[model samples]
Target: MSGAFFNSEGISALLQQFDVSKLVELSKKVDLLQVIKNLNSMDDQQLAGLMKVLNAKPKNRELPEIDGDFYDVSHTLTPEQRELQLKVRHFMETEIKPIVNEYWLKDEFPFQIIPKFRELNICGVTYDGYGCPNLPFLMEGVLAMEMARIDSSIATFFGVQSGLSMGSIYICGSEEQKQKWLPQMQKLEKIGAFGLTEPEVGSGAAGGLTTTCKKTDDGWILNGQKKWIGNATFADLIIIWARDLDDNEVKGFIVEKDNPGFAVEKIHGKMALRIVQNGLITLTDCFVTEENRLQNANSFKDTAKVLQMTRAGVAWMATGCARGAYESALDYTRTRKQFGKPIASFQMIQGHLVEMLSNLTAMQTMVFRLSEMQDEGILKDEHASLAKVFCTMRTRDIVSRAREVMGGNGILLEHDVARFVADSEAIYSYEGTKEINSLIVGRSITGFSAFV
Candidate 1:
């Protein structure tokens, strides 16, 4: 080796393996000639060690880009919408991807990312007013898919804030309420949670809410425990849904976190969506003023309106989860060897990959049309329910197949498929399970309610 070998290109390639900024700063502080002299004096073994430390690699070789969107569904988006989609994708890959498994393993929320998350400017992407972006419903679905494609827990947290909490305030809130909360919530300055499902009530929340509310001389009194409330542990405000004692109608109330009667206990030992901060919220005579009550939310029907919109988002989430698992499994199969060849080269593995992709594609198209109907103002409850039922059911299959393709690594969290596999179970159950949603569709199509 000669000093001529340490030319600009060689040095540049060597520095590329490390942090460029740190190398630039060090170059500014150190003497280049002395560094080159020290390098020249090193033995062959010492030079090999230095190269190992530098992580030198061959030049001009790049892996083909891997895109999960085989149908090019993203092409339907406008240039601006596509830009937003890629921006969110980059954020998830660069920021959330590295830390997600670690956080999921510890069952802890990454609170430090809140500031970075606010910069995405995607909260309440569909709503028109109150400082929201006022984008189309399709764009909102696209963003949901992008987020969930990386980590379903982060997507769940976003859905709780953007779809459920902000949506309740937007669709059923008074104008004053929207003006007060939507702005701050859209900016993510104030995180919110939706409290509807109780410890005793899951699919029967529509007509069988045990949480009760009563009007008083001071304000309304709420007494109920809300289970599986995402972001509840640290949410600044929680939208508590309770049935009124006077008229037996469901009502929505904005319960502040600092209320004396409100408390939250973290739900631990969750196998799925562990990164999500689910809480068992206890409301013991939680008092809310008349102004805090959602002026338009008079019945469970109004609450159903919020669920109708959010259930569509849930379908998108399930699709993303499937996409994530399928992509991971496909990549693993291509790299993982069996019988002296890539497992992806095997017919059985290819069949599994094709099946996963088929389900994912069907889900993508279904939700795309579902969101289009929503944007057109013709989205019905049954339409949302059908998509939710089909997509989540298919998602369960896709994730399982993904796990099968990965073999033992599918059960490992670091490999990423296991988290999706576990989280798919939760998705299958939440936002109205498959049975409830299927019944909703069945009732609509047959004109007979079988949900007794």
Candidate 2:
């Protein structure tokens, strides 16, 4: 064949071997005339060399797939639940993973992701009505794990909105309250925060909330301060739990963000979960109408119900934090070389990875059962608290070991394990500290209330 014909045939053959879409994309970037002219100018030897190069596919090293669930705990999920779990995992990996480190470093929440997060349609995962998915508590646990696996701050933010805030309405709010707030909050159109913990009372919030509420003809007057409230700085609604001055019992109120007496100052200088926008809220005579009061929340007992449910989620979050750290460290050790071989090949490194995985798997299985109890309507404060204590404590160990395996990189946020390490501290302390949670379980089994 002539040179021009040979060039034309070679180009046509090469195009045929590749995908049509790829060729179309190439056409959009290059001039067809110029490409053909260059092809035609090449000598026969050069043309043959070019053909060989084009035909060769680059060889890439195939790494083994990382599976954190060594015991296949996910097999317990139903097909639909499993599908939802995978969907949430994909959303976390794609949407939250890229920017989480940046946000964590800056100590800022990524408001830009709210609209994208709404697409997940996962808020209020277990509630029965008001536009919630109403899947199951197990599914909610899975979603929490997935979110925390990438970023615990994001998980805490979601938990505040979906679990603590929306849950108060679902479990304690009146029908009308649920009808109004749950739907909007479930859609992420209105953000919400749970204001139960105060500077004076965190683990003791149920019994020792000094933020008082006074009922008047005008409405309920709320006064006092709430500290460490996640999402308070930007939330549209805050579920404030306060002592009803008349009865000396805790009552829940839905306070609007625009309320004149409600002021939120962002809590800064956090060493952990920095991406979560925690606020120190000063509620100075905040007026909430009787209509906004949670009708079912008559006492501290009612408030405890909300904590019982969300504490389960906190356990799941701890599991996810540990899982993220373990997986990141595992991947690092596998590729990180020492003495011309992956450190993962060393006996000590393998032992560290194994210990991390053991704790992680135990946490995963424990939370799975905890959610199962919630789904069965048999979940108790002790059940939730036990998981919280165990998971958080084990998570601390897992993350420290994770950081240990990665050496210097483990302490750096960019590697992802470092964020898990720092965030685990917050998770350990929040919801309920290890000591408090252990006391809860102690009270349950021993019939002695040791909380003072």
Candidate 3:
């Protein structure tokens, strides 16, 4: 019976034979008992050796620590903030990084990631009420930076949902709209997309929007094609912006994916942000009820307010892209050997590393303060535009330097830095181009309207 029981469950049954409490007591004195028994028989050397063994403390483990920012911007964070930042980063690396490249290669969004993303529960982070965390905007910026650090495409995908889409509804949508969407969207039960740019209207979208909406007795009839709409392919709802034909002012609509006239085709073979499922959206006489129309979005001015809010987040995202490239390059240089020494030891290589770090640190500090202004209600369009232009422009330089240091390995997608290098171009163009952003700042400082 004992043998049979042991075969089925070895130690569990045997545990009944011994008094665990007594055994634990015996274990505490075993060394002393042996020492007393052997004291008379052993030499001084033997006693000393035994004493050393019994008193020895465990050695501290030396695990390889990951330092993405060599200057340690993490040190600037509060202990709690840093903890949250690390939590999000680990989630991204473990959950998102492994599958991102495969999806990028196939140009397919991973449906599997939705559950993992929901577990994060970070949507509408800085907003109050409506199932939001209401964390500081700095934390929001940190989260964005952390996401982009691993993969910019994922970051952009999230920005479209959280910043552009949800923000529009939050800032402009009616209280009823907020009650209907923000909570479910916050939980990611329904994904959202922002549609602003058109196929022909690239940089001058504000003045050059060709998409138009006509009001009717029934509702509103929308006619337009929206280009480069991230997440539109799978999004449950898209915030479509179009000029009102009667008023000639921009208005926003909650366009459902299942609408009769709505169509989407994936834009493929992109050199940048390919993991993002950008779609060319076509809405021919798409009927949107007045209830679905955003109540507060009266003109281009209302639309611009939402853009102003999200532009700061985009700047932080650009900084994240630069930080990712710099860290990858730093790690490669430190580990990769040349002539039996680490390439990081070379003076020229050191110069590149320093340059990357300088730009990254500048970006980090700038975004930190920018988010602070946003939280304080002091942020302006110029404040957001300056960071966007500076960070994106610097990110291009940082990623290029990162790739150059890796030699041929830089071009290989497996190295991870190459994707960032490519994705920075899209970041540079989207959410207002570098030229457009610079002009925004230029207009603020000189009090001159340069945007044509």
Candidate 4:
């Protein structure tokens, strides 16, 4: 025993078995000579027990499945819908996850992924006809959650194409407009943009859209600047919502990207949603044929209908954003060691994770109900607005807590929480701001208008 495990050679081999820093720590805490003396006094049976302890692998350190759906909200979908949800999830996790950080850092859209994205056949997910699946609004909400759960920029890009562009035509454009664009757009051959938020007007778009359209004898002339228009930089066409000069009411038009006087400048210097390719659209007397006018979009009410629907989808996106951040933080805490144990085992860190899950669960459940109301045709502006307000607000909180749990690593993009933290701000403000959405709900509940 003295020569085998207590000699200089045996000690050298034993020290090699342990980590250097850990050995240094252990030496400082315990008397190494005394430990060796005690080890040498142990009998054969005691030595066997010690060897068994040393050879035993740690109780399988694999973490539990990283699911953020605490309430089983996804199980509410049918088997078919659930399958599709997972398909998109797999695609995003495998394809987009690998390249997202690079493109996000460079502020470039990955054109290479577009072909794979088209393979999903999920664009215009809830819209009927023209090669659309015509699934229920609930399924659309789930898909939105799954997309955003990985990255919100891709979700926003999809939302602009599927919800805003196709929805405007499906809800307001003539049948001819639907036939011409929905098929190609659904196939993702022709990308689309939604231009409603303008350089000066966002929350006041309903009442004060400075982008104006004057009806020409042969066509309509659109003139104004649209800010934060997603996909505007490369879209085949953009659904421009401008106030009609003649009627003084908001109207929607399918403004082809190549149409004369249509120019788009890619917006830069963004801190969030960098991969979305948001464009500042300049419609310098841009002309749209009579056929291009969304025939049924005669008033702001029609535009509001599209917003109401997409806003619900935005609420689902908020849940996905929160879930993504929470999952990343949770995974980090489980493996990140501090004080000689996984930080996730600490009470404070566990509390933070629970809080994040609580907010995320609430968000998921709220959007689930919101989408149901939409499918049942009972959705209103206030209902959608209420969801957007609540979900985005909660998402902000979840992401904040997620960042908190990660310590200094929270701000790093490689961990994924930092991206969620920044992208959340953009979601909180777009579609509708928190203050505006709250007022919409307030107006409905209190029987008083709160618009300034």
| TM-score, structure 2 vs. true | 0.86
Give the alpha-carbon lDDT of every model: 0.92, 0.91, 0.88, 0.92
TM-score of each: 0.86, 0.86, 0.85, 0.90
* Per-residue lDDT over 304-344 for candidate 3, one digit per residue giving the tens place of the 0 to 100 score: 99899899888889998888888888888888998998898
Give the number of the best model, judged by TM-score: 4
Encode model 4's per-residue lDDT on 1-452: one tens digit a residue: 53256877888888889999997898999998899988888888888899899999889777789899988988878889989988999999999999999999999999999999999999988877899999999988898989899999999999999999999999998989899989999999999999999888988888999999999889999999999999999999999999999999988999887799999999999999999999999999888999999999988889988888899999999999999999999989999999999999999999999988998888888889999998999998999998899999999999999999998999999999999999999999999889999999999999999888
Q: Which lDDT tens digits does candidate 1 get at residues 1-452?
A: 63555777877777678887887788899986789878877877888899897997758646445577889887889899999999999999999999999999999999999999999999999989787899999988889999999999999999999999999999989999999999999999999999999999998998999999999998899998999999999999999999999999999999999987999999999989999999999999888999999999999999998998899999999999999998999889888998998898899898988888888988998999999999999999999999988999999999999999999988998889999999999989899888998898999999999988
**TM-score between candidate 4 and the true structure:** 0.90
Report the poorest 10 consecutive residues by lDDT, candidate 3: 1-10
**If the candidates were sorted by their TM-score against the true structure, best first, what order would they fall in?**
4, 2, 1, 3
Give per-model CA RMSD. 12.5, 11.6, 13.7, 4.7
**Which pairs clash inside model 3?**
none
Model 1 residue 250 CA deviation in Å:
0.8
Pairs that clash in candidate 4? none
* Model 2 worst lDDT window (10 residues): 1-10
